[model samples]
Target: MFDPQTQDQPLPQRLTRTLIIGAVVILVAIGGFTLIRDQFTEEEPPPPEPSAAPSPQATAQPTAPAGGDNLAQVDDWFPHSRTEFAEAGGVAADFAADVATIDYTRDDWDSHAERLGQWATDPYAVTLTTADGVAEGIWRALANDADAWTGSADVVEVTYFDPTSVTIVVQVQAEPDTGEDPTDLGEFSVDLTTNEGPGWRVDRAELLR
Candidate 1:
């Protein structure tokens, strides 16, 4: 038969069980505190810093002016064709006459020199004569020695015509009173410009060959 008093656990065994229960309670409390701390804690945010604004865009530069060879602009400036052609032809004929016609006498030479001056631009006129006297020094020397010389020009064509300018090509012939064959002066090109005044004036003259 079992005794009721003896069925009770021993003192040492009861102390061991109490210690195990206390350890389990301590572990549960530590876990719950850790979870609560994590849930409530907040992280710090970074402070803002100042930034520079974008620089303003630079402006574009202007273009430079073109020097000479403004033919396109010149063409636009004068629109009339028939009038320009007539005026240019007349000017070219008068200039050719002035250049080819020279007399042995001083009076006739002076008149022709004056006409030539009127038919050329200031720059070219300077070439025909200086402030000292009429005609270049070399031409004056020839005219001084010669008894008689005559010349004429036949305008072959007026080409590269523009309102302000044109190219005059002509065949010039000359003869002396010494009774020699009429010399073929060959073809010459005269570039005339109307920029000086109302009438076309010679800017430059050159031999083609």
Candidate 2:
């Protein structure tokens, strides 16, 4: 509503008062509108923070077998090198196979003894030639009865090793010429020792079973 007293004022004073009142009304209306809008308006949530990426898993390294380092020291005090042990293992397996094999039609006791001696040390070789009761063993009996046999041997592993010797265990299988299935003669271990010449030779042999 317009006040009549305001019209009694001078024009400049009247104009200034009108402007001041109009400004005050405009500020009040703006403040009221802001408060009302705030009550009904929902504040938008802050933009979601980006999640961190997962870290990569570390790869596992292969662990060496136990006593692996000892292999490097194989020839330090040993009679043979690592390479020689491999050769000796093969020789031992061959000797074990020869011991298991018996062919009466092919080799006599003397010839077999000589063949065995080629791979054996003097002590072992002597036993092959003159060992009593060997002629009376099952193989000899089989040979006496006109039977022949064949055999094969596979090296299982080196059972014992040292500077002076290594013993290899083998699985021996034999089949008689009588159409029978091959017999598993059980395991045999051959001990090899460094001899006078280059490589290793069989010193002893034994049946595990």
| Winning candidate number (TM-score) | 2
lDDT of 1 by residue, 61-92 (tens): 87656745685466466544656766666666
Model 1 TM-score relative to the real fold: 0.48
**CA RMSD, predictions in order:** 13.3, 7.5
Q: For residues 42-148, what per-residue lDDT tens digits would candidate 2 score against the true structure?
A: 69889999998888889898999999989878668665676887888898878766765788878878887787788888878887676542222435545643367
- Once fitted onto the true fold, the runs of candidate 1 whose alpha carbons sit more than 4 angstroms away are 1-80, 107-113, 130-146, 178-180
Q: Deviation in angstroms for 46 in model 2? A: 5.9
Query: Model-by-model lDDT, in order?
Result: 0.66, 0.76
Cα lDDT of model 2 overall? Answer: 0.76
Best by lDDT: 2
